[model samples]
Target chain A: MMHRIDAEALAYSYTSGQRVLDDVSTHVATGEVTGIIGPNGAGKSTLLQLLCGLLSPESGNVLLNKSPLEQYTDRERARLVAYMPQSVSPAFSLTVREVVALGRFPHLGPFGSLGTPDHEIVQDCLGQTETSHLATRDFLSLSGGERQRVLLASVLAQEPQLLLLDEPTSSLDLPHEAAFFRQLRTLSGRGLGIVVVTHDINMAAQFCDRLVLLGKDHRLVNQGGPSEVLQADILTDAYGSPLLVGEHPQTGGPFVTAPVGGI
Target chain B: MTLGNTRFLLLLGLVSCAVIFTCSIFIGTETLDLGQAWRELRSLTPLSEAPTLSILLMQRIPRTLAAFLAGGGLAVAGCAFQALLRNPLATPYTLGVASAGALGAWVAFLLADVTAAIPLLALLTSKQVMAFLFAGLDVFLVYLLAARRIHTSPAVLLLAGVTLGMLANAGIMFSRYLARPDRLVNMDRWLMGGVDVLGYQPVLLLAVGVIPCAAVLLLQAARYDQFAFGTTLAAGRGVNIGRLQTTTFFVGSLITAVIVSEVGPIGFVGLIIPHGVRLLTGPSHRLLMPLSIVAGGAFLCACDIVARRILPGETPIGIITTMVGGPVFLYLLVRRRFSDWNV
Candidate 1:
């Protein structure tokens, strides 16, 4: 029942030889939320992509369930790990229900239509992400927050053990952001491994069980509990700016904020 | 679009195609009524006496079938190409296969006298054979130009294709300049596009080339749906991007080559049928491929009917499709459903 993905000492560069990620390592485990938090150009999105096998690391390897990530076929890996990018703009028209139903394609038998059970699972995913109301609407017609929730429902329909998301809540308003984190916790409670990349350090502090913080130089700066990683000195060093860390008035968790000009 | 309507629309399209196919046989200028034609078909009367029946059995039937196959195949190929490139305007024509085919046929026409004198030119004797060969060459050249970057940038593939298309167009112009006047008229007529064959030979040729490739495109229907968002997202959903791209491009090109070689690169059907079908049904490829296939066949058959009956002498099918399909496509474009059109 314990599922984990371990990425070890991964390095990567684009077509140009300049490396974006170097000697970076992290892990995501079931029943816990892992957050990759960083400043701009910190390779957070690239790391998430590497973790989910979207991009192969130039040097180093990823292990899923103690087996090499490259060993799994596309369908096999898809059944285990689902990934959601920062945004989705479909060039073709599809309704919310249809897009969510697409996640079941890996599990279906060859030339199989969705059975009653598959439909039920799709319906359940829509409900879980609070996107049931938008199930019949065109995916392109929804607002950013609504589309994000619908996408979450769609990925959840894959029934993946490990879910990796890149900045899933970046465009969401405050209430929508809070609602999304609550949805993540509920999934984590049900023994799913959820890894999210985001710029919202305060939300990450509140929601993440483990934080992997990357600095501007695209190197891991800190990796630990929210209380340890959200410290003023650590935050200031990683983000390359002056920052203040305090306690949340409501949840009493770590709260990260920045000074407007100076302090 | 919902999954439920995919089957419904396909059935509707099939019935429409069937109706159009049957009506096309009746509407042509052949003098025989259906009753007399049926009697002639049943009886052992020689075709020498049954003039109307001969026209019906020999000319219209085969010609109508060829139109159906060419239209359906081109539309399916274009649909696959569009989805593969994620561009609405993409077709095999965009990739230079049609232009190369046109040049190949023109070259064959120009070299007709030289084919017997030179052994090597003997193999390229028929326009169909030469057209297919040059289309394959065009595909190979475009592949060579775009293969490395195609994974990261599909625009490179389109650029290579467009460049090749321009070169092939130049080749066609040079060949036309070299051709004799009689050959020029023949070449021009072929260029204009027609399904005026009198027997089953052309129909059989198109069937041999089209049926299997279009079947492959149909099999890849769901993968096309996954690709609508882009390659990375498609890969995340368990599609093998390499395999899908290969199948979409190669199979689509092969279908276009087959159709273009046989029918002289008929335009508008490949470019518009899929979009027109998307307007009627939604954008699901499962619905799009088969519906496009049937609707494309029907559209061409209707156009061919007009081509045959509207004038004292027959008009080219290409002209009718463009003349009719252009206004209809624009009407569909300006109409209600395209508000969701992204590609």
Candidate 2:
């Protein structure tokens, strides 16, 4: 019943005077996988940043646990929300375990070293993300899919109540993308709120409990369960083209197919 | 890159440092008379009775201490610079702080000669103080320009440092032209980098300045590891990036400044030690930073011994480091595949 993160009428503009998000209000609830789905440049990433308090909105407020997000210290916010950006590649030859251990920084003191329990959590997270075998390997040598999973394990080690990911599957192959979403679905069942920005409408429909569609103008156009919001006309208008909405043959969930020619 | 075998390597390094440091004190121009030195060391004889003790106290001890300080300070500063810039080639010298410090010392030399009575000239004549002042100025200028333009991008900071260094070098040339011909050789000698001082003051000063900076750097080992993941990920992991950048830049420059002011820019130690240690210890700063400091200090101390004994006359320490560092750097480069630069 409690909201993990609530953004009220958030707006943001770059220094070049170009607005990214305009009057966008959204909230992420516990134990649900919420997907922000839209075409390119819909400000989904910006909205996620605002929710994580990485960027302050030009107007409106983001609250965490009923307190203004800005009031929490950087370490406190990091402990509450785990965010994984779109790209993470090691510039040095750090081992995979070292990379995942970074997620425990917010919980560590200035001179504190990792103790037994911390190692246990790191191992558990690595196993949950299917990366336990790669713990001793060099992070720089991992394949793209493996790298993303390792990064996900790192974020999971933060042990936050809210998890935010930005285009995590943008570079992944089809099978890996499906596997990643399945992992997220499994994670959401454990009662953590998950918000992911994705362009794959079908995956959003199949795995996400709710979807918020953003238009090109950087406004939230519609929000609801997959069957209620994935209407043909709404998606066509949102994407600026003709789209077909259908049901998955077996699961009966919503599916999307862009038409070859506009009607 | 793993610490599993590094404990053995670290133990070997520490023993070598101790052996070199002790052997250096005994093998000066005149071999320390062991019987007399032992008596003096045990306090069985007074200073006037034991000439070997005077030689050891007045010359060998301070010189060894200076060499150790210069080597350790530069290497730790090198590690910090490389991590902050995310570039292994980013040594403290790359930032132009050394050149500016040298220019400051050059100006002080000229002023001390032109006027013998002024109290201000008396202070500047120390040369070390003057070098620190100028290094501070260079660091300030680089940070100011970077913050105003690119908000402290590592690439921008590197460019700014190189430009400022070139300007300071030009100032050095102009000062040299105005300097009396007799003082020109003195300028050249200072730049050559020697640790032949005869008193305890400089050694004490260097130790007091370098140890705290090294401690601060060691404390940030975890943060440096996060920085290897890129700034965005570092911040996501709760690192205060702005504060980390400022603290590292300030402390690294200060360490380099104090060492350069004391012994001039001992070239290549900064660049070589970190790379060498990284090869053995991997990239975790927790093990990399402190090990580099110890290895660098021992390395330079050993080089000084070679400089003192290899030829009839002593060669400058900088020349020795370059001669050694150049080949090692080449080996590292030749061994590395282009894929190592993938990140």
Tell me model 1's lDDT, rounded to 2 decimals: 0.82
TM-score of each: 0.89, 0.91
Instruction: Give Cα-based local distance difference scores for all models.
Output: 0.82, 0.84
Quote model 1's TM-score for chain B: 0.86
Per-prediction CA RMSD (Å): 3.5, 3.2
Q: Give residue B237's lDDT in candidate 2 (0 to 100).
A: 73
Per-residue lDDT over B1-343 for candidate 1, one digit per residue giving the tens place of the 0 to 100 score: 4456666766777788889999887788754487887788789789998877888888878888998999899889889877876766566776788888888777777777878787766765677777877887887787666555634244566677778989998898888888787777877888888888878988998998889998888988878877766667678878888888777767776777667767786776876888878777777777778878888888888888888787657898877776765675456546644444563
Deviation (Å) of A156 in candidate 1: 0.8
Candidate 2 residue spans exceeding 4 A from truth: A1-3, B1-4, B40-50, B108-164, B330-343
Best by DockQ: 2
DockQ score for model 2:
0.53
Query: How would the docking of model 1 be graded?
Result: medium
lDDT of 2 at B154: 51
